[model samples]
Target: MDTLTSTSANTWPIISNIIGWTYFLSWSCSFYPQTILNFKRKSVQGLSIDFLYYNVFGFLCYSIFNLAFFFSEDVQDEYRRRHQDSDNLVRANDVLFAVHAFLISFLTLSQTFIFKSDQKLSVTAKTFLLTFIVFILTAIGAVFTEYIKWIDVLYFLSYIKLLISFIKYIPQLWMNYRRKSTIGWSIHNILLDLSGGILSVAQLVLDAAISGDWSGITGDPVKFGLGFVAIVFDLLFMSQHYIFYRERYDFYLAVDDSERQALLPTEQS
Candidate 1:
């Protein structure tokens, strides 16, 4: 019985590590599909500039969160003390993924400037930027005055990352609805993103099971919520792609057929 139990315990961490790496890969590559699609199309017509705006800033926050968490000895010690399972703790991959995400987002933003597209910054984008600026200034002031501890600042950054993750899709969702098409967007990216989200959540679950610690399941609530919400939004985008946007393309094909037929008759006459 001891041998069996030991074997089971040993296997779970290996499985968890596999899932974690898979999640990392999925997320790391998720942006490429959209970036490639944009380059191929040479237009951001159906894409939302506001979406890019929020994404860039969101990733910036995420990068900061990862950096602060990785560097702060206090945070690291607390995490170790709380979890008591060092194997399942945050690794270099987490920081690497954050860095990769930020770079990809910046590249996507560059696309907006390089490519000619009808998409423009919406009122919502402006509002978000302004609000984010104010929040950053306030946080800086608080930090300078020592009104909030560095650990608390780390928590605040984590919250910002969570907020950004939760709402980042709104601009694109709204834009797709307004345009009634997903022409300029890449469904492939959403598919990859959904895959990453599921894998990330699975990693968390596996860690919980392996360590036999569930108290902290929600301890990093924002990280957990980010994965879950990303999955939700990815599905939403997929539905939009198949149900709504597909019909639009079909209608466009029909119109083209009719116009071609009309021209043929005129040419025959």
Candidate 2:
């Protein structure tokens, strides 16, 4: 069993590598367009805030978890005689770190431009901003992690931010579930999120099992568990969309038109 455990840890790199890139490609190619469309429309009119907020939070937590895993390893290696610079785990971490950095960049960029008006930024311009923010932040975080004693606090902030962000979504979830419609939901986004959540939990469990650390496997299981539960809810949310996908109704970009129609029924009717 011990050998098996060690072998599993050794194999984690390959598994994680495959899973991580799969998510990256899927999100980049499939889900990103929906967000871009929503931006063009300037209405999250049919998009679910609960889902988006939860995802942002989840990414933050995952980022922190990744950082902690690295920190713990650095501590462990410090006690050894001569540390090998090219360990498999180190290489895996590097890959994961880059992946997460990209995730954060894309997300933040999406948030910034996806909610903005068309006049504000061209598609190419938004892409540039996303790339810039992602690069700058990833570089800064990497540097800080290596040189600063207080950097662990940044990881702590990431965890806390996730929790707060997740909590902010509860009301939105309840309201949407009660209404039985995704009046403000984006199906593709939620679908991708559900996939991401499953991958995240799987990665966490694999890491925990390999390391023999139940705590690390489950980061603040209460918070983590809630996030997982939220992901499941997201799946259900997407189901709601699937059941109603063929229904045709206008999702407006603004409320002004609706209000005007109400006030002057004779003008158009």
Candidate 1 lands at a TM-score of: 0.84
RMSD of each: 5.6, 9.2
Query: What TM-score does each of the candidates earn?
Result: 0.84, 0.53
lDDT of 1 at 264: 49
Query: Tens digit of lDDT per residue, candidate 2, span 51-141?
Result: 4544454455456554554556663343232223322122243336435544753564466455652223235434533553574466557
Show where candidate 1 strays beyond 4 Å: 1-5, 78-88, 247-269
Q: What are the lDDT figures for the candidates, one per model?
A: 0.75, 0.49
Worst 10 residues of 2 by lDDT: 81-90
| RMSD (Cα, Å) of model 2 | 9.2
Overall local distance difference test of candidate 2: 0.49
